[model samples]
Target: MIAFTAAEIADITNGRLAAEPGIIPGSVVTDSREATPGSLYVAKPGETADGHDFVAAAFDRGAVLALVEHDVADAAGHNYPAVVVQDSVLAMGALAAETVRRIRAAREADGQPLTVIGITGSAGKTTTKDLLAGILAAEGPTVAPQGSYNGEVGVPLTVFKADAHTRYLVIEMGATGVGHISYLADMVRPDIGVVLCVGTAHAGEFGGVENIALAKGELVEALPATGTAVLNLDDARVAAMAGRTRATVLGCTAQSAGDAQVRAGQVGLTPGGSPEFDLFLPGDPNGHHVSAKLIGAHHITNLLAAAGAAHAAGVPAGRIAESLSAQAAASRWRMERTERADGVTIINDAYNANPESMRAALRTLADLGRGRRTWAVLGAMLELGEDSIREHMAVGTQVVRLNISRLVVVGREARSLYVSAVNEGSWGNECVFAETVEDAYDLLQAELQPGDLVLFKSSNGIGLRHLGDRIALPPQAPGRTATEGSALL
Candidate 1:
């Protein structure tokens, strides 16, 4: 973040300042523990906790100012140094928007272009952001979200991490409603936009799958006529977004999509379960063969989207392929692999799960579990709306068809999966519902053999990723119980 005085912040956020005019904050933060000297702590209210309760702690930790909805007084009965706004989260957005504008102007005056890429989709937003950031950072200073920080507050926090020295800014946009992406785009004003795909990850909140398409398309709709919109030609909903944007279209596909500018041919998975394909760029007849370090064949869509965005931002196709070939899964629990000394391989993709990602992870598990016993510890896929039971049953059917050796379905929310597997001819101990994470852990501990491959997958809210972490450890490594880990998460 650029240097800003208390008075400047008040003016930018349309808030009333209680602090001294000369006080300058070095950085902005929401968590009090992250507060440092000259840091501006945001006292924003959350679901279970109120930020106002932590203002004193933040001040004690060297924070110079607080952005709060109300003035918080010290023990001495005097108000603490702060900027009082109607809403601290919205104020954070204002500060973030101004920060981007200042950085953009500074880079332009220095005769260097600042390329901002806004990426959105129901799934793969974080992976695509990581891939693009890796490619961009190799060329210049790049700033991107920490993980899946793509919501309202998350987007602003991502921008606050940028400064005039940042040459490229990658913003991952996520939307649960129609105007969410548009609001985020107005803040960053990206030069290039990438729409990965519209899926049923949040179909409940968005009303339907078509509404998800409407929400995801807003990223491309926000692009300028002079900019480029990278559309996934492999997905019909994403490919149709080309007609929604005024910007030039750059289409990417895992297979030949006829008119797609960026394409991958000879797509297949490596022996290690990573995707390997021949990438073909526009105006280039020759294809660059790339063996990705990231696991899962479904990642081909993400790989192509990153390649198209990088190419549109002036990177050569060869360099893009090289950068991609070296990038692995940077975020946690998204097909993250761990090989234990006991000859057991744990693929932890429990950070998030939907119909699309769930299927993808299961396919990868089946592919990698060849010649070995496989265990899939799947939890609930939330927010499917009326299709919740159907989707869960479909996943169970896939598990059976894939010939997975065992199925340990955790939680009653996902009991439909166990039922479906049984109905699909998996009998007795072949598929069982553990009813709890601890029960699942005990079952696995009693039966897991060496050379077996296990996968843990669920939505973040379900906390299966923590269980995956515990399971990835050696049987005697001494870690929190699955239930305890899930509780902590």
Candidate 2:
């Protein structure tokens, strides 16, 4: 994203240049539709579509250069500027790494510090990233990824957004296997690494919970000796990572008494499920009490992690708590609460789901729905491999154990949940099974009453968030329904 000529980019990516050496791209893009003047388009071949097919389209949209597996001009007979490489995705990463190197160099030359913070976990990466970004932005220019852009390609795209004036970069690292996070960490070596928690979110992909811990610790492992490693004292697996990094270790916890250098005390939740707690930092006898606007008690740990990272970055404890209290949910479909005009409260947490996050959402629902009829519309938690059935059943049992009013399990993959709910003492319409989202929508429409609280949750691929969006819409007039709305539900 920093200015680079085609020749310089080719050298940075270790690829052959097929364009004039003087051509300089203003930005980088992967999708052809996002291409703008002086943009460098990276063509990646995905499972559904080959990006090489859109080379011409990208050029037509004012792209100055393209990174491809081969020169498009040779095959299509159109002379488009390109950087030929064996793999475009890897080349994009290389370019991003180089861009970060340049930004760091420029900051050092100007005698200003550039802090790169890396955050990783089985869950809560995006939420923590959003919280940390809010805290850091108060000090100077800060950049963070949009949504859940925390993967191989997404990490690089996020790094490319940084410029010379940027003081803090919050990189969310996600992994499905042992070396995934390690690979991303090598690109943007973080000065501050925050490990939220190691959970069963990707246990199946990583082979086990232990393996998930190994993958998530990669961020802390990448920190320099002078850097800071923020570890969660509550999660034993994450707490153990303190010994794995060479950086100065800072422990964060929601508990009042702990070995943690940064912690919270007198923790309580508001009626809306937002967290209120006394934030404690090192050497501070009288800590500041924070009332966060973000919903859910699960956010307590996330706030602690953000506070620890910000403290390590030289932010005052009071300012960190103040920034956190003023922050709202920046990412969609993650504890996004909406109250309908008809007195119904809809909590849409369908961005993604795993056992840990699923339980957190259920607990939040129980706490917020106290005295009101509660409905849980849940779909499958994908990538659980061997533990899928057991985890789903556990969630179903929790729904019953918590005395939630209704359990609506959508899709065949989630049938285990409904069966388990019924087996766990739910009876007579307490647990309903819907083969699709449409069926779940109809079931809710027919039975849902005023003052009911409903939660929609699932992995993003399951598409349950769309149902939450529909349910959040205002009530329609009598005998008048929008056909477009019904089509999606």
49-162: candidate 1 lDDT, tens digit per residue: 999999999989999899999989999998889999999988988999899999999999999988899999988999999999999998999999998999888998899898
What does candidate 2 score on TM?
A: 0.98
Show the lowest summed lDDT stretch of 10 residues, model 1.
Answer: 480-489
Q: Which portions of model 2 miss their true places by more than 4 Å?
A: 74-76, 480-483, 487-489
Question: Whole-model lDDT for model 1 versus the true structure?
Answer: 0.91
Which candidate number has the best lDDT?
Answer: 1
Q: TM-scores of all models? A: 0.97, 0.98
The positional error of residue 261 in candidate 2, measured at the CA in angstroms, is: 0.7
C-alpha lDDT score of every prediction, in listed order? 0.91, 0.90
